[model samples]
Target: EIESIANHYGWQIIEQEIDKDHIHILIRYSPKWSILEIVRLLKQLTTYRMWQKHEVYLCRHFWKERTFWSDGYFSCSIGNVSKEIIQKYIQEQGR
Candidate 1:
């Protein structure tokens, strides 16, 4: 799902890692899209799809609220760092 979203917007997802409770994605996005917009799109679409596929199981945990991801997110630029280093870091998450 995330890959599809990235593809739709022409964002390059260099690497990604999904943990039980969170995800790490190393994505290269266009300057036209703000981080807020990207985060909103990801959480909104992924939450909707997840609910569609696993409503029964999700309802058990999120019965009181229709929330999947947390309200806050963490994002940062690679800055002067190497892309491969970040990709390796993302890949090693949750292991």
Candidate 2:
């Protein structure tokens, strides 16, 4: 469902994985998009989709506030960086 909204807006997901309590998605798009905007779109649209599945979590957490994700998200530049290098960097973060 998240993919639907993203793809609709022309955002491409390069990789994705789910951990116990969170999700990690590697995305790519043209230079016109901003990481913050993409993250906002993901959380908002995904929250909408989650309701359809009768699932709700951090939406109500005191600390989650209005963001399904934290106030900040991890992002990096793909410019001049190989996919292998990017993958290794994200992997080494131990996420």
Among the numbered candidates, top lDDT falls to: 1
Q: Over all chains combined, what TM-score does candidate 1 have? A: 0.93
Model 2 clash pairs are: none
Q: Where is model 2 poorest over a 10-residue stretch in terms of lDDT? A: 58-67
Backbone clashes for every candidate come to: 0, 0
lDDT of each: 0.93, 0.70
Off by over 4 Å in 1: none
TM-scores of the models, in the order given: 0.93, 0.68
- Compared with the true structure, the alpha-carbon lDDT of candidate 1 equals 0.93
TM-score of 2: 0.68
Per-residue lDDT, model 2, residue 65, is 45
